[model samples]
Target: MDHQEMADVESQNLETPPDVFLKGKHQVTLKFDDVVYKIKTKKGGLLAKKRETVVKEILKGVTGVVEPGEMLAMLGPSGSGKTTLLTALGGRLGGKLHGSITYNGEAFSNDMKRNTGFVTQDDVLYPHLTVLETLVFTALLRLPKSVTKEKKVEHAKGVIDQLGLTMCKDSIVGSPYLRGVSGGERKRVSIAQELLINPSLLFLDEPTSGLDSTTAQRIVSTLWELACGGRTVVMTIHQPSSRLYYMFHKVLLLSEGNTLYFGKGSEAIEYFSNFGYAPSLAMNPSDFLLDLANGIYTDEFNADHTIDKQKLISVCKVNCVAQSKPALKGIYDSGKDQNRLQEKDSEKWPTNWGQQFLVLLRRDVKERRHESFSVLRVCQVLVVALISGLLWYKSDISHLQDQIGLLFFISGFWGFFPLFQAIFTFPQELTMLQKERSSGMYRLSSYFMSRVVADLPMELVLPTIFLFITYWMAGLKANVVNFMYTLLSLLLNVLTAQGLGLALGACVMDQKAATTLASVIMLCFLLAGGFYVQHVPNFIAWIKYISISYYTYQLFIGSQYSYGETYPCLTGQCSIVEFPSIKQIGVHFGLHDQLMAALGLLIMLIVYRLIAYIALMRIGVTKN
Candidate 1:
């Protein structure tokens, strides 16, 4: 295979610096040792997509200490692997890590993650909550009992002030589909949330990226304030303005997963050119480093740390090989278990599971609160139900075959409308969930369960409204048999619609694609859903099994007045009564298609839930 193909196959390990790529299993730690990193792609066809590489090896000798009251600003060109470094520092890297990373001399692991805070590029806030509300909610969960609600509120307010967001404190934080704060304010809210727990160290990936110059400056200043307050802050930046560059206490510059410089931000120029690129001169420091560290300009400044960009990159990669650090010095005899306070972290149940669930549950409940758009969904279900019912009114029994055919459509519409709303709006919630889960604030199960619960009320309320309104208006036959059948049919319809939505979402990632894919799935299932049309050979029968429509279709037709009954539209002689009986309409004595439909619906619900969770968990553990 060609280099790019090889890159595609081993993409995860490729972009890492040769140094980091060399770290063996035993030396792995959050700390960079002989570890090198690069910004390589797994395999996406085009070379342009690969962008840039970070460290090749994590130089083992570098101290893991990011002391409080200090700032480590990662500076390099767009492809310099700045963000990769920050993620690696937070222990969220893609593959096996190298070297040991100790948090106050304690080995860093998943347990330590609870105490660490990370702010991603996107500001993943619930657009519903105001600035103050978002921070307060996070604070309530992260703060200890020693801090009362009053103090939590105070703490939130203080974080807002510290981040320079007092002016927009009460502003809503999302968009038109909802309502909310500005992008910059939202970013600060994300940062403020991470700060609520008062973690000694904070890591942010491209915190100022995509922001206006003024906004970027303001954000950096906020970080400077935190660092000044004795919090260790490390962040990656792509061409920070001169003013922003001055805010950093230390700067680590990388190129092709190689370290160009690591030390004081002010020392960057002297360290590079002094090692012998430019004889002596002053230039925009971030630009100078970028041109040297990464091939920012193709034809210009062509050697390692030289005035030429591409050449500088090549030269830097050649000579800047990560120097291997000496092995551990102190406590060499200590066993691995000595580093862990518990025998097996998972073996011990959390002392207060209720509290953990409660904290996550509150967020979920609040997020599902109805927004203005919810009206659109209410109107939809209402429209389909009443309109379809009116059309299928209590008609004649001689027209049994026609009415049964109409029954299939009725069940389809009942299920279809809800499916539409979910395909469109539900994916948006998943994006927010992905972000929250990334921060390690809540588990996927907690969010998923809350969503299922919140949706139950929505699903039931809207369908119930539609059913009752439509049922009365159309005046379908009324008997215990019909009523029970109708109720089960409605419930089954909702369950199936929801399951389909969940499944579609799990399979597709993009919103537009998800919508399109869901439409296709719904269409295919409905077409092959049942024996509504002539059953083809055995080949197509399996399609029936996969068909959500078949079950809802069969259930709806088989539901009520199965034998025969006299009925009127209550509006016209337009009704039908086949003579009271219990066998022709398909209803058998003591036999309930409703129960069968219920079981079928339950099976779909479970199967869909299982598939969705599997897809979701994989999504959880993996992100592009």
Candidate 2:
């Protein structure tokens, strides 16, 4: 291709509407066949047992030629499968996906994520960062190297203005505990974050679901404006008001996994009327659409509940002309039909895994830095060290043994922190990450590595400072003995604990359950740490080896219990030199033996990370 020809192709690609996916010269189709889902238990065991399919064996097909620059609003009732159909189109649906969905003449892949942006119901904004930072970071992760930083900033600003968020541009986004922007503003910020890449297509799920009537209308208006700018927007809207109904240029109506109508909003009213229901002057169009869709509560609109199911069946029979059923019956037995992917041999896939991996890693690192939880953690750890160290103030060595227990408690407790944070934070963030992952923004490894890398600096620096302040203030050991020993203990605690966190985060889908599980595990480790309890009995003794705190404690106690050390023996009431006897029992190799006990804990960390990685990959980085 010549330079001008290539430029024209690039321009066409850049201008491709989000809704009107360009598929070759003019052929376009939105088809779905027997998209069925069966609910399973927490243990991967089928409870509904192929019975109670979340979505029945229904078929939906829409073949309307949506123009390149238009807004297609999918309006329906709650359980009418609007979101499900959208999920399917976005390439993020669950269950046995038997149908084929193609975009721009190619099936959606993880690689296409850079071109697609999905805005979810939940907003996963860092509470500490201003709006600009969040969007900038998102663009950094998803945009190409060709897009310059200045261009990136301009894009973010344009998205902000397009979304009508200029007033709150400099403000911090509000979260559960923090007070910053409003709900509607936060939602816009989420949209703005994805808009940085200037995606060809944008998929939004209930963008106005939680907001008030006015706010929802404003958001929809902004989306409409984006459509005017030549972006393709397909959103799932549930029960929109009469005033909000006119914003859509295109309307896709689905009922019970069946396509009722897929065309202009004006034609939708006529289509419903053909089935014997007319939109009343006083009635809301959205409510009318839903009433016909749900097959219930249509007295105000038409008093004809029978019209819904009848229309549904009629539409399904017409749209879903699937002559043959899916080759597989149950989802469990329907192993991934990856054979279809083999046809893509001719596609120019970016095969550079190494380059992609690096790109993903850098993006993840950026995200990790935005996590204020770790920053708060660093501050808290430092504060605790300073306050505790200064309070002890180089006092007598009377409380030496108790102090040793305290040291163990610190090491063990801090080690458990990452676990708590991941379980609580990760599941919640799963809402946002799931959207990004589905849209193909980045890889799982990139996210995992980025988070781990970002946390390393804070984790190492905080504990090291804590150890120094506490060691010197407690007047334990002064020379290199104190510095090296404490540093090593802190390092082990951080790594092992973070590994546990990742494992728990991946294992438990529910935040509450994961938190409870980690708490119990921490308590067990605390006991096995040999602080309050004397020794780990043979039956429970294995826990001592597995517990990270056990190793750090033993090392601290053995290292601190030296000849020149002056502290109270066991009872906590003795001067440094007044203790009966303070002696170092372990030589250099003995010290090695003591530290070696933590090897099990380190191994557990590795095992946990591996398991977490496997779990994340299997179900995907999104919610289970």
Candidate 3:
């Protein structure tokens, strides 16, 4: 059968009740008029002596509408403002936007946000997570607290079934390097995540860009069914096959930031034909439309017939002005209804603080479990621990220098390892975080706290294991109290270093730059850690005070030996308090005060994390 007939048969088989998911929810009617978006960009090369700021318009006076139970497909070539206009309609665009975009004759509000779903082209998913787990976590975080946990899971399963993902429900989402779900399945999973919220309006960016033709048809058909269920679905697409073209209820063609055509998909050919832009032979409607928008003429077109881009834009502008007047008037006439909407939209988050924290913490733990406990990471820690243990195996008291060096190595190893590992946490997850936060899944504070809390145990486990293996082999101390003190100090040091890494990652938001800065900072800490240079220059002496390694080394030394402990002197004579190792560690300068060293580390633990939290708050949720 042909595509249209195939689509007709499939639609008949796939039809369901309109209110299956959106029952009792508001049905949104999206309308935009005179929408224009511009950005300020610099116009000069890096080596140029001078640079100039220029305002570039991305969308120019574009207008259209998609009411309940209809789907609008935005079509254009690259740089035609298709994505920009879609973002504006979705209320996610920022920077010099001049337009009137309304939902159900009301301005965009928190309520509208709560009821809208935006699926980005890139599927921001945890590759290790099963499709079921992914959707369940989304439902738990985004659904209102009124729904019980069991009911939320049920809803997620329902969405999975609705989108034909039941077969892959237990499968991992996967990534480029890892084998998992197929590309089409991944796209549906993205759509399923948004559908968990039962949004009244859905916006997607090129939902079928990289898929095969059959998969693309299936995705578009699924969207058609969603629009059939009373949701306003709008998406940007490149050239689509004629079958998929006919699936959309409305088609909006854009060219160079201007609207080329808007109205019913079935009538688009007739509308364009009226302008004498019809193809002489059979052609995919989308192909023909794109050629006109891109100013490309096929062999089928008459050699003598020429089309002017500006003239087409002018005609579309006049047509848009005439078509948008009535819808714009209706929007202006609903001031009272808009006020009611504003009041109804007061709830900023669907779940309270505590609930958001618990749900997010659980999800974070599940998603990161493999990374934190992978065989490779565990083996790395074990190898390092074994090497350190064998190198420092049970030395005599006369070898005080070697023992102290081992302690310093312990401090330096942990201080470096955890910080480097933690630097990738924020930069890698920034995109996913922005997507979830923009959809109002939870508060940034809640997400931040849950993330830190979830990582605490995982971050500490390896270090604890390493220390247990290395401490006994090196015979540092046998007393339980002393061992506890050393372990506590090591854990605190790990946390402090990790906190610094988090701060750096959140501040820079770039993995390479953050790692580079972290390397420089860690090296400075190590050089001034009091083990390498006994007396740093007085001008820069304060560096040791803030160094996590400095405090940790002091704590390790104080825990391993007593203030008046004696060691066999190299010269066969020495005072108990004047031993070379004791003098080298500056025990006389209060370096043996374990309490003070621990307190310093404790302060850094709080301070660095506070800085990280502040940086995250500044990063905030991306609205543009």
Candidate 4:
């Protein structure tokens, strides 16, 4: 074929959509039997001689089945284990979970998790991304590769339409500090993200928790539509409106971690009525059910003669057997159907490592650009650099005191600034990262590695500019090689500082706590920094080894004074040497060579990053 003909063939191939093997509808029936979850808690003061550990059961023998084409809304007051039950069925619970959970008669595994999606109560989303960008990114990372690029884009658009987000497609999903989409729209965007993969089963925890009545109705209505299309949906809701209550096909009522009632939503009112807890014409059915569950009764109902809790449990247990017949029959039918069908391979992550990194890099870049603090950050750097240059204008080695002073200032400036900037990096994105991590969007390594790589350009840019303006203006080192080494040392110092910051952020999840701890630690390191105390006591002298500022000061001074600057003696005569050479000074502190110091900085960078990675892995994603 000619060159033009080959090009045309490639173009056609790029545009052609890959064949989509629709394996019928993804109708799933999730069944859980006697699932019990518990956690151990410590009860004691910090100074107590002995601490007691107590085991608390968060979920108690929860057994139920949610069939496709049905919506199960878990209703209960606060602290009633509603969200816990939903999470258990969603396969998100960790630790030793008692009992069995099966999908379509098969036991639950990672495959079941891959085919399911969960939407938490909080809307975890990229605040700086537009609705379209957010959904497209999710689609790229989620949808199978067999789906063409065009098809994925079309799919994202379709989800936006389905979620009633077309009006805000171009609007940015903003946070508390940034103004963009409304709360309702942001919630829809969160739902749209999970909808990209067309999950067979969807679990939502309070989908309408913070939304207004109308918006909540719309969200629940959307779930109803999804159920009608053969997707099993289980959600936890508290005090839903009457209209919203009827939208759910089934309702699972709970109180104090025990099932009070489980049956069709329509039958719940009648079921409660049979027990003498029926609602008046003016009262909402949902309100009456909640009242009954919480042991609250209005004047219309005799509070003195309230229905006994044990009696109600006995009635619900008897009804559960009758109510489960349809679900058991459905499971049996599904088993027979499965024998005649070809078992399709479970879905895997669509993107490769390189692709994930690239896409994440692009998204991070876009987010950083839109962040209001980003512009402020650049301005802050420039202003600080300019001020430092002005403060130490045309500094010379004629006075060794001034030279030492400049070195200490340079050390402190780079140490403090970059450390705080890096400190907030992990904590700021902790929620979003944890949410995406739970969804299997990308590996922690991919995210951490890509983030480090993505930060390279910006992380270096400001330091380079600061070095250029300050080094020449301060008249530190005039030679090109000396200037380059000085610049490289400062850059490495910044990287090391940032690494420490990231480690602190990951080790401590709370921002205020991490910030406070980082400040204290940085201050301690600063005091141990060489210039602050020329002669350190032997007792605390080992601290110098871990202080980046100490090494930076050594390299900064060594790189400059190694050029043999003449110092004025007491008698106004030039002294050949009063202090040791920069290399010799570093040797006294165990930084034997400039190469060794640079290598030490690099080592610190690697060590801290490893620490952060391990901390993140250990403290996995938190559900609460």
Candidate 5:
């Protein structure tokens, strides 16, 4: 295309029908000049006396322009700064960057972020959620509130069809351990997620890394169509087949952080041939370019050893200046139209607080329902309840010690079960959380609150079932009031233990470490539960005060004997309150002590979860 035609194309607005996905969206032209990025690394071995900080250049003097309705493919070998340069242009890179990157002649701003969509190389998606479900939730959280719920659902469906995901829309976006959609379909689903916002500028990192050649071609074709529909698409690709290479409108070739070629994909072979670096055999253009970038030369082209990779880099540097100057001029001339496309980004989130909470709660429920209600967990609760009930069946006043033992068992069992289960929650989902938060999807408060709220039903059900079975079978207390109090104590203990788990998970963010730490902490709490060791030393006596198991055990003992009941003595008359088990459990303190134990549990419920929320906030949303 000529310069004037290019200018006209960049200036005019491409209109689409109201029902179309890309309708009424602003088009962005991305321009970067002499981009350079560097990072500091420690340059000493482990045994070295001192480690020196060394500055390493990742991207050196890279420049390019991707006009609206054009697809720019950054091609290079591994570790060639392809991902770094792409990240820098996307405005998501951190560290020391030296360059000027702008969208439509304007600097990067919140509005640009709103209009930009970035798809990472690894697809960050929930393994349990179906494709359609995933897209629907994303739309609900991302689409403007002005749009109706029905409209968002319809839009998600349209995007699914647009990306040819109709066949697998109902399938789960599975992980390595689970079977779901194919790699190609998963990649397309990832693309469809970003397309829901109708972004004007799309950045993808290796959209076809593990796919076959045919699948890679299809992905590129979709991107090509997206670019043709007035969105500027930029992606980093390792190598592409000949057919795939022809799909990109522009290709930026880099080697060792230096640009080797930056021009039309169709003219790359001829451009490199002029430097006496042409391939003799008929091979894929991408393969030839990679070979040249990696300093690999054929025997036919090695006759002149002096003509090396440096000469090719020097030649391309001079040619790019002359070629890019004219294109850059055409882009700048249309700055007036580009300036008019700036969107109003006053609203930080597309959805309100209540909406974010409800949507996230719904998503969390769906994603966790399987694991929570799985057969293994159900069987575990049922087996333990049956075993405990059989072990302490029909214990009356004569078997008061047996009943106390069962109560202690309940405390220790729940204290450990929920604590270990809850520790894995945050660490497992940290990646997805980071990805969504980085995109400004919702508030961290909403996510954390929804997570806690979602676990309420799932976390409480099994414990209630266990208590109901064991309470009636063991015959602890025939009265309804006593049973209700005991049930309440157990349920509260479960939540408090789960809260401790969440705090540890969020604080450590590593599954193995969190689990190990939780085990050690729960063991200490169990040991100090006032049942195992009644008289702890003064230095360690405070452990029982902080132990969830101790409070729960105290509540159980207090609830049953607080009514001043008496037990049958073997030799003479003796009150149940005078027994060592009952006395040590603090039954003499009566209702006041029972209330204190309940209050202690309530305080732990709030405090541990509050700690979890603060830790999550400290994690922050920025990815770098």
Candidate 6:
């Protein structure tokens, strides 16, 4: 059956909410008039002398209206601007937009944006979150405070049931790194996440791009059911099966950012037949339309044995205008409603800052707990530490070179571990973070702070373990006060390295790039760490000031040798030696007090974190 008959059938089957729940909720008519959108992008390579900015038009004079309870499918070939138009209508597109978009005969406002939901082409979900947990978190953050927790959960369950995800409700929504649900199920979970908000208008981009025919049909059927429930729906779709094509109540055809067809899905074939572009009985109507939009036609339509794409497109546009003018005029000329209510500019974040921080912290902890305890990671650190300890094997102070070598090893180990650990912080989750941030779930600061808070305890665990194994095994400092001071300094040093990693990750939002940059920086720091090179040229000596390893090594050296005096040399003569004295290391790398080195490490921690925060804020939300 066609979507109109199916919509009628599903409307009767849909369970209606209570009158109180529907008090201020009503379906809205979404209309866009003479819409035009373009983006200015710069073009140049790194070595180019000057960059040129050019405006690329995405949509041009697109005018249409989607009435309440209708499912509109935007179909086009690649680069036909289908996704751009969808984003523009949803108010999520960032560009030069020249048009008026209205809902229920009123201008679009923040209230409308808050009530509308846009699902991106990609599924930006947390792989560790169960479907139920993900939906619950979304509801808690997006639903108004007036909604009780129980009712919100009930609503989430209703949405889950509607999306046919009851069986996998408790399963994790996994990604490429982990396996959980099938592609179709994951797509439904994405839809279900948006449905948790009960939006009046839902926009989806290529929801069935990768699914099988049956799965795609089921997804489209679910969307039809939503529209049948008095919600307006619009989606960008590619080649669809005949059965799925018929599931859309309205079909909009776009070619080169211009409208080619805007009418009932059933009438689309008839509308194109007038231009001598008839589809065979076996042909999928959706495919036929896309072929025409892409300037593909049979010999009959091009009897001259030559086809001019621009000419065909122009002819089709003229014919479409002539045929669709009356229907288009009726929709746009409809008078405004006199009783439209005043819209309040709703705040993007529904919860206060403190609440957002707490919720995010809890969620992050749940998501990362397994990784924090991964056996491979734990064994990796322990094995590395064990090997290093065995190599050093408790050297005596008389062997000053070995003792100094052990100190440098400690500095390098702690410095590299924390930096590597934190490099993946922003790059790995950039997509998910941007999606959540765009939805206005929380402030960027809350997420950054929550990550910092959630990561500390886990970050501290491995380093402490590594230090305990290596400290006495290498026998650097034997006294109680010295050991405690060394341990504290190492912990602070780890934190400082983590801050550096975070800053680098935020500045460069690619994992490979950040890792490569971290490696380079870590190597530079090691070279200037005072133990490797006792003397250096003044030109690059400033690297020592920025190196966490320099301070860590200095403090460790001071802590170990503060009480030692002269020691017997291998030549059988007593040599005056200030073994661990910072004053004796070399004037360029010397520190008067271990406290100053520890304090310098603390300052680096705060400074790097601040840089990360600024970089994250500047990175802002990922736009596409």
Q: Provide the TM-score for each candidate, comma-separated.
A: 0.77, 0.75, 0.94, 0.90, 0.91, 0.88
- Candidate 3, residues 421-443, lDDT tens digits: the string is 88999989988988998888888
lDDT for each residue of candidate 1 in 281-316, tens digit (9 for 90 to 100): 344668767766654322234433324444544444
Off by over 4 Å in 2: 1-55, 58-67, 110-112, 212-218, 225-231, 279-282, 296-308, 315-407, 416-425, 531-539, 562-591, 594-605, 622-624
User: If the candidates were sorted by their TM-score against the true structure, best first, what order would they fall in?
Assistant: 3, 5, 4, 6, 1, 2
Please write out the lDDT profile of model 6 over residues 1-624, one tens digit for every residue. Answer: 543354455444543432232446667778776689988888998788999998988887777778767889999999999998898888776658997777776766666766678888999888988988888888877777667879888998888887888999999999988998889999998898788777788999999989999999899988887787778899999998877777777888888888878777877767666756665444677877787787776544434222355665566456655555554456546634422425653555677778778878888898898787789889998998898788877776677768778878888988888898899998888888877776666778888999999998778888888878887888676778878877888888889999999999989988899999999999999998877676678898998888888888877766676443545566663433433333434422235556677888999899999999888778867321
Q: What lDDT would each prediction earn against the true structure?
A: 0.62, 0.64, 0.84, 0.76, 0.85, 0.78
lDDT of 3: 0.84
| Candidate 4 global CA lDDT score | 0.76
Q: What is the TM-score (0 to 1) of candidate 4?
A: 0.90
RMSD (CA, Å), each prediction: 10.0, 9.1, 3.1, 10.0, 4.5, 4.1
- Per-residue error for 615 in candidate 5, Å, reads 1.8
How many clashes does each candidate structure show, in the order listed? 57, 9, 0, 0, 0, 0
Q: Considering every candidate listed, which one attains the maximal TM-score?
A: 3
Candidate with more favorable, higher TM-score: 1 or 2: 1
Model 4, 1-624: lDDT tens digits are: 432233345334433232232355456777776678898989899899999998888876666788777789999889889988887787777876897787887765555655678999998888888999999988877776677878989999999998989999999888888898998888888888887877779999999988899999888878877777767889999999867877777788887777788877767766776667665445555787777777765545444345566677667767774577567667756765742222464544556777778778888877775442478887887888788888888877665667677777877888888788777888888878878877777767778887877777777888888888877887776899888878888888989998998899899978899889988888878787766666778899888788897778777766765434457766674533345433323433233666776777889999999999888888876421
TM-score, candidate 3, is 0.94
CA error at residue 613 for candidate 6, angstroms = 2.0
Which is better, 1 or 4, measured by lDDT?
A: 4
